[model samples]
Target: MTHSRRSLLAAGATGTLALTAGCLGFALGNEPLEFDSDRVAPADETVAETGYEERTVEERTMERTEEIGGVERDFEASIWLSNYSKSVDYMGQTREGSAFAAVSVPGMEVAGQSVNPLDEMSNEELLTEFLGRADSDRGDIENIQQGESFTLEILGESRDVDTFVGESELEGEPIDVEIKLTSFDHEDDLLVLFGVLSKRFAAESANVELLMESAEHPIDT
Candidate 1:
């Protein structure tokens, strides 16, 4: 069953790209949700608010192990969340570029396959494309008429790949999310994880434009 799940995940990566195009034209729903930066404080604040009873950052190391396709994979993840944004660092024992960071909502899970941002493209180009697509589809339920799964193809300077975008509602706010997984040629038993975390920038549909303008590197270190 584990092997099968891994296989399904792999296939899902490819299929996500293909389905994005069709999903881009549908209306999913239009229930607005409130997004208060204060609702979910950052890791540090959460710890403080909890009276420091929880584990400290120095003591906490997020890790998960699983066997996929007859191979054992171990993942260690660290997260830093702030009022403005969130970042995650994922490391795998066998992957070449074992480390990568994503800017998103705090406590977001790393799902799907892994992708290397240092591949043949630049971060600015990649982020630009991501924000552009999200902007084009902002507040438009027509893009999500076919359930919550959809994929879109994004063109880059030297290469192009399909990206899967998923949507959900939280606290009356619309949540737009994406995941990209790619296999590295150098590693036979490793996969890359690429993810996007986003919410409506504001009450109006214009917030998409702000997010595009404000998007930056999730992790500085």
Candidate 2:
């Protein structure tokens, strides 16, 4: 019941990433639309070609409360999602699919009082948790750099987010990642949300920048 190799890295490593399609040209608002499970019907060719199950679609909506610094932050959002699970499937021994995106209520610290989603784990922690296993083709550890936390207007509110991007080799192949973590305003937790794209999708630096700048929420306008 495994999805794919990248999917496992996506979950165990950096939390779930998100793919975006404008939710079907729907206005980016708090509106629950009908999502047919059949839309994600597995392609017969995909199953036949890869010995994998066809992906199915599911309507997903959720809400959760995260505690940060003894305070509560509430979050909610909905999307059509697919699931993947794998174990020792690669070559009957190697691995893979999914981690859900995270959402944080937007807020910032004031008067030097700390208030952001659970402090984002340090880059070192992230490396251990996510990229520690990468095998650089270069035969040396890839250079990783954590950017400073910054704020931008997301969903009509000012928000703070931490970003990280690193390079490495996995099984002798190159691996590069860019992650953006954030905390909600009214809570003390941090989350991974908004969107994710492969190098093919994010070919331009600007596309990656856009994903880091945008976000999703259950907020009704």
**Candidate 1 positional error at 171, Å:** 13
TM-score of each: 0.23, 0.33
Task: Tell me the tens digit of each residue's lDDT in model 2 across 44-132.
Answer: 34333333332333444344443323334333333333322112232344432111133332222222332332345553463344332
The CA lDDT of each predicted structure is 0.27, 0.34
Q: lDDT tens digits, residues 123-154, model 1?
A: 33444433333212123222321123222221
Best prediction by lDDT? 2
Full-model lDDT, candidate 2: 0.34
lDDT of 1 at 9: 27
lDDT, residue 183, model 1:
18
